[model samples]
Target chain A: MNRLFTSLAVIILLTQTWIALRLPKGFYQDSFLLPVLLIALLAAAYLMSRLTQLADRGKFWQRPCQLAVPALFGLMILLVWEAIVRGYDVPLVLMPEPSRVLVTLSNNLPLLWADFQQTYLKAVLAGYLMGCGLGFVTAKLVVRSPFLQKGLLPLGNFMASIPIIGIAPIMVMWFGFDWQSKAAVVVVMTFFPMLINTVAGLRSVDPLHADLMHTYAAGKGQIFFKNQLPQAMPFIFNALKLNSTLALIGAIVAEFFGTPIVGMGFRISAQVGRMNMDMVWATIFVAALAGSLSYGALALLERRVTFWHPSVRREH
Target chain B: MKPQLKSLTQTQGFAVLTLVLGILVIWYIAALLMNGNQMINMLERTGQSWTYTQVLQGAYSIQRPPLPVPHQVAMELYQSVLNQAVTSRRSLVYHSMITLESTLLGFALGSLLGILIAVGIVHNRTLDASLMPWVIASQTVPILAIAPIVVVVLGSMNLTGVLPKAMISMYLSFFPVVIGMVKGLRSSDKLHSELMMTYNASRQQFFWKLRWFSAQPYLFASLKIAISAALVGAIVAELPTGAQGGLGARLLSGSYYGQTVQIWAALVMSALLGWALITLVGMAERLVLRRRGLTR
Candidate 1:
């Protein structure tokens, strides 16, 4: 059944693509093939569902099958998008085709690379490190005092909920229109989340474990290192993962306020004004890749650091 | 009297007041130091020697200082919010209302879409496998990077003002809801499912009676996050579009011509707006949970 479904899906996909490509101009107004295309699309979806069902049964193929399922789904979405845009003659400004976006990305690799380096390498990296370091240290210091904790925790929670990105303009004014200002914005954006999470993580140590350590006559330092710090790893990693995306966003948005030249946000806003939707998309592609890569990297690190975490450890 | 004083000292409100006061004092000092440099420069350009007290006063009251003092910002905020009519372009109330409109609209739409998607994912194995990964992946993209494109694209299509901005908000606010709702819907116990099976409950019955109730806390938590994200989205959407009637536009215009006081006022307004929105969500959560007798 699975084999039959796969072959049927592939055939339907090929036939639909061929027919779509062969459709003449003005075919959208009145085309008998439209019903055929719709039927084929539904059939393709049904067959794909069957294939996914089989994928769940076979342990050996599960990983690759799970991966392929989403990839195939993404492909179908792109195919449909292309068809709709072409069939209805949607303007390029409104929505550029995935193919055109790819072409633009490939064509402007050098430019995109420069923007990536400027935004991601300099601003995001510097700001993430500094902001997270400050937050962790502050949390450590504040955690020692109940008074400070009571004061800072509520403040931090309030500040975190507010749009810290609004500080982009103020940072630009203070630090000037360079990568430094963007970095400043990122620092402010990332700091509170890290502080709040680190505090919560440190406070999450099991009281039973603490008592156990106390019975062992553990010193404050020993108790913290052996109990609290290790227990906080997952929450710290959560902050790290959250900050990874936030740092990118802060840098990009800050660039909107002011930047020298050649940054992801600059390219996006500039190309957007010129109605170069493809270039804007290509820039977005780069930003998305960078953001996901950082997030994925942090996630991998989290699994390694918190391997004992129930969420990390699999049944196997 | 002794007990009352001790209780007051131990209260969260007291802690907050202490911290806010501490922040204000620090802010004033920092403002003096920062703005003093410009004051000194101006004094030198005028070729006049200045006393420390005179420079202190000048720094505290200078228009367009690098950092405005708290009082200056407060005054500006007060004037903009209360002095002007709500319909006036200069009123912070008007700008905030515009932003709030988009934020709420997008939030509602996003919550509906997220709930629908969550329900679909829970019911259909194919959608669960295929769509869940993309939902997670969508968040990693720098959403602000696309704000300009979305604004312009929608603008070209004759969809301007709040709609384009709201679309961006919906894009942002939906992710947290989808993740939270999916988790909530799947959180029912195996024993509960077994009980439902013994009773021969239909899928819809299982969902409405068991799954939906189980998901309430998660939905409220995600809603809090979503509303704030929606506000951020509305603000950023305003930035790209250069719209004249939103808090984002206020920030941009303030930035353009060196109106530090205006920028600070707008920032404070947005923070207040976010706080109010989150409080409203909290209230709703409380009301809903209490009505259902689920609150502990």
Candidate 2:
């Protein structure tokens, strides 16, 4: 089975190489050819599977086959996307091919890097920290004062329901068309999630634990730190995880309103106006990379911090 | 226990009192700072301003920002609706209707597509393996980046009108529904499936009787999110096309003319529209869930 799988991979690569060689120079230059080639590749794969005597070792090949299917599907999509645009002679202004997008990224690396620094490094990071910190503090305050819990929770809900687009322009007006405005939007976007999650987390401590702490004559601060805070870590981390994505999105979209010619959102909107689809795609690629990495890092932190939680324990 | 209950009630009462007092104090201070005479004078001054910049600066100088004071906006809004010719030029109500037409159309199309894709994913293992990841990756390419390309491509095809804008909304709104519906459909427990199996139910019956019913809450939650997303998508769609009608167009024009009041009024209207849409869905959810005895 292993041998058969190896042969199949070899055949697929060789076929692709042969097809690449047979095509006219700059065949990939035309996006439409890519889709046609992809379809042919899929057909070849089907036929290869039929000819190969791999049926007896089906279970053995299942895991590799499972992995291969998604990879092939992704490759096929890119191929078709490449082909259709090329063959149809679709204007580059409409949809640039993935290869062209890559070229644009490399060619304009410095500008992209600068936009990244302005938006992600300044606005997103600053706003995320402040919002999450304030939310945490407020949650603690509200826990201590039932009056606050009653007054604030509904207000937060109302605030959360206000769409980012609605407040973003207003924020731009208030904070000016700079990173400050974007950060303000991010702060608004991140605050509610953190507040709600932290409140829930603090409340998540078992009454029995609280009772024990009370019996031990622990002070309010001691009880909170020793019992409630530890219990709420998982929920707090969940909010943080959510806020990471929200902050990135908030920063990017906020830049769309009125920005000073730099930032991911500015580049995206500006480039689209210039009919530079490739650069728009490139900016998106960087944004996606940043969002995913931040999310992944937060997830890692959650795992580390909440290692004592049952959910983490079960995974191990 | 009585003391505990009394304390709880007092605390709640205190909280409510504080909130009310806070609001009253803010309002009172604001009113005192911008006395009625000053407000009238500012309004009178703003009315005399001709250039866009002057009007904007006048509006900005006011305590509450007079660009579009409540009454001015109300008058404009009334005029837009009543004076149909206003829409032909750049009326907010007229553009809102144009945008709404596209938003509703896009939302319907996107919801249908999401359900179909979800159904395919739920039923077919190969498709589930191959398509789900790509669907996720598709969102990685931001809609803002993609909207213009879609507009240009569709425009070149001579497909002008609300459909192109609606298509953009669909692209933006469908992902959430697909993800939500997929999660909802899979929420049926093993015991429930086994019970259906014991009843000799076919695959279709099993799905209809169990999975579909279980997915309603998730579908509703997703619909709330999707509908707002559709509105946003419709607005963003207008940005690229430079379309002359819709709320997006109104916003764009408002920005160009420095009609800060007009922009604020339009924004408030959109927010109200969003709230209304969400509320409508929530009402439907309540009615449906109530019928099913699922409301807690």
The number of the candidate with the highest lDDT is 1
- The alpha-carbon deviation from the true structure for residue B168 of candidate 2, after best TM-score superposition, in angstroms, is 1.7
Q: For candidate 2, lDDT tens digit of each residue in B1-296?
A: 99987787667566667786786567545434434445556657777535445434444245434233455556667666666675476566677788788888998998899999999888766666667666655554556567667777787889889989999889767876887788678767667777888999988997899989988976886787678778878887786677987777777677667676667667766666666777787799999999887664
Off by over 4 Å in 1: A19-33, A140-144, A198-238, A301-316, B1-4, B45-48, B152-158, B184-215, B286-296
Our tally of clashes for model 2 stands at 11
Evaluated on the second chain alone, the candidates' TM-scores are 0.91, 0.76
Candidate 1, residues B1-296, lDDT tens digits: the string is 99999989987788889989999999999999999999999999999999999988898998899999989999999899999999999999999999999999999999999999999988888898788767766776677767766776677778887898899899989987896687677766666777898999999999999999888876986787789889988988887677878998898888888899998898989888888888899889999999887664
lDDT tens digits by residue: candidate 2, A133-167: 99999899887887788887655544554557656
Candidate 2: stretches off by over 4 Å: A1-38, A41-70, A128-163, A190-247, A293-316, B1-90, B194-202
lDDT of residue B71 for candidate 2:
53
C-alpha lDDT of all candidate models, in order? 0.83, 0.73
